[model samples]
Target: MVKKILIVCIGNICRSPTAENLMRDALNHADIEVASAGLAALVDSPIEPTAQAVLEEQGHLPSAHKAVQLTSQTVNRADLILVMEKRHVTGVLGIAPEARGKVFLLGKWQEDREISDPYRQGKPAFVHAYALIEEAVHAWAQRLVG
Candidate 1:
């Protein structure tokens, strides 16, 4: 069984954090850990407001999450690293090539999809992005845990 999961994106304030929370909620009963990080994170910044609002609307709380950077240490710790886009895979591999096999697109197990970033767009865009992340995370939880 996969004990640890790391979700990755660009800012860590949007997509990855949502994915991480969704996965955590779905796998609440499972003996696994879930976290999130960014390739170009804001270091200790809080999650974006738009992202937080969308999550709250969906009954998921994301107000306490702070952005974290992706590092070799985090990469090494995760049993599975689920990225938002294809470039993230390359970027993570560049940081830790040994993590190659464990890294995968969060949406890959579903429809070979890519979850687009909604960084500075607005509330609507963030909502759309959250929907995508929610689907991907739920699918992952089912496949990996259920």
Candidate 2:
């Protein structure tokens, strides 16, 4: 059974962190750990303001998450690494070649889409991305819990 889930995106402040926090809230179990990292991390940066606002609106926990770089160690610790886009899969594999079997798109089951980056984009963009992350996380939770 899966225990650790690592979510990935471009910067960790926008998409991945949203997925991480939402998943943590949804799963709400101590045995399962949810975390996030970035391909080109903003390192030490907190979750984007608009992203945090969107999460707050949804009644999810507002995380004070610092951006972390994706590393080989992080890759190994994760039982499942769900990335926001296809390119992220390539970057993670480069860090830990053996992570192949465990990595997947966050939106893989739902049309295999990419959750867009909403860094400089306005609240609307963040809102839309948050919705996508929520949907994707719920889909994953159902699958993983089974």
- Give candidate 1 misplaced runs (Cα > 4 Å): none
Residue 133 Cα positional deviation in candidate 2, in Å, after optimal superposition: 0.6
Candidate 2 has a TM-score of: 0.96
> lDDT of model 1 at residue 35?
95
Residue 118 error, candidate 1, Å: 0.5
Candidate 2, residue 49: how far the Cα is off, in Å = 0.4
Model 1, residue 26: C-alpha shift (Å) = 0.5
lDDT (CA) per prediction: 0.89, 0.91
Clashing pairs in 2: none
lDDT of 1 by residue, 61-133 (tens): 7648888989999999999999989999999999999998999999896677998989888788888888788
Any idea what lDDT model 2 has? 0.91
Off by over 4 Å in 2: none
**Model 1 poorest 10 in a row by lDDT:** 55-64
